[model samples]
Target: MALAGCGTINTVMREDGVAARELKSQKTYCQSIPRVYSGVSYNFCRLNGEPNPDGAFDGHLNFVPFVFVDSLISGILDTALLPYTIYRQSADGSIIIR
Candidate 1:
């Protein structure tokens, strides 16, 4: 049961590969912008969130915490960077953060 819900963010996003580029783009974009979504980006990258099937199982290790911890970290970061990021912009709160 726990393992089922661990796929929270992943399940919400389309897995047909089309969004890989966007996912990668968002991840890299956030990586350069701030450390707020770094954790979420790391998790997003873990999905090998790309169109290639080559590295599908690359990081096959268990990373279930990405669902919750990343969100928590991003929330804290977003709150801290409210001034710099501005009220209109949120560091990139991944679906898990919602």
Candidate 2:
């Protein structure tokens, strides 16, 4: 529970640098995905439709599911890149759009 709280804090309270930019951009990507067939992406728009602590972290949380689905369509094995993805997210935040 405590660890989960840290995710948001980590996202909002992190240093503004390259990593921060990447995280923000990921969220931007999620928002940009068309609503036609991307649940995670659509949820991204909903989850991040407003500015809030959770919204900032939603990028990280949604990344896996996004990649999970994106991978299927694009034929990219994103799960295999979990370490980078997870680290990017944890350092940035995680997905919770369910």
Candidate 3:
């Protein structure tokens, strides 16, 4: 569960490939994502744009439930990290995915 959140994945273990490309495809005007609630924001970015056919997989379908659970966990983690994140947000101005 610690590693299941998209925010964790994006911020800690992201790699350049289908997911990165798909995120890029979202075309969100957001050049950066705030550290506060970044997990939720990552989920939003993932869900915001048109679905990426190539990024979808049967195995991933099975993981949907975990992803939802992880989002909740991520939210809690985000809140816990608020003070530090707020400072990071001001210093860094958010994580740049674009």
Best by TM-score: 3
Ranking by TM-score: 3, 1, 2
How do the residues 1-98 of candidate 3 rate in per-residue lDDT, one tens digit apiece?
34643565554344434334545666544455667787767666655555546654333322345557667876887787788778867876667767
- Ranking 1 against 3 by lDDT, winner: 3
Residue pairs in clash, model 3:
none
Alpha-carbon deviation at 68 in model 1, angstroms = 1.2
Q: How do all the candidates rank in terms of lDDT, highest first?
A: 3, 1, 2
Question: TM-score: which is higher, 1 or 3?
Answer: 3
Instruction: Mark the regions of model 3 whose C-alpha exceeds 4 Å error after superposition.
Output: 1-5, 12-22, 25-30, 52-66
RMSD of each: 11.7, 13.8, 4.7
**Model 3 residue 66 distance off true place after TM-score fit, in angstroms:** 4.4
lDDT of 1 by residue, 1-98 (tens): 33322222232223323223334443332222223334344445544423334523223322445435655654555455545444323544332320
- Point out where model 2 deviates above 4 Å: 1-75, 94-98
Model 3 residue 16 lDDT?
A: 30
The number of the candidate with the highest lDDT is 3
* Residue pairs in collision within model 2: 60-94, 61-94, 61-95, 62-95, 89-93
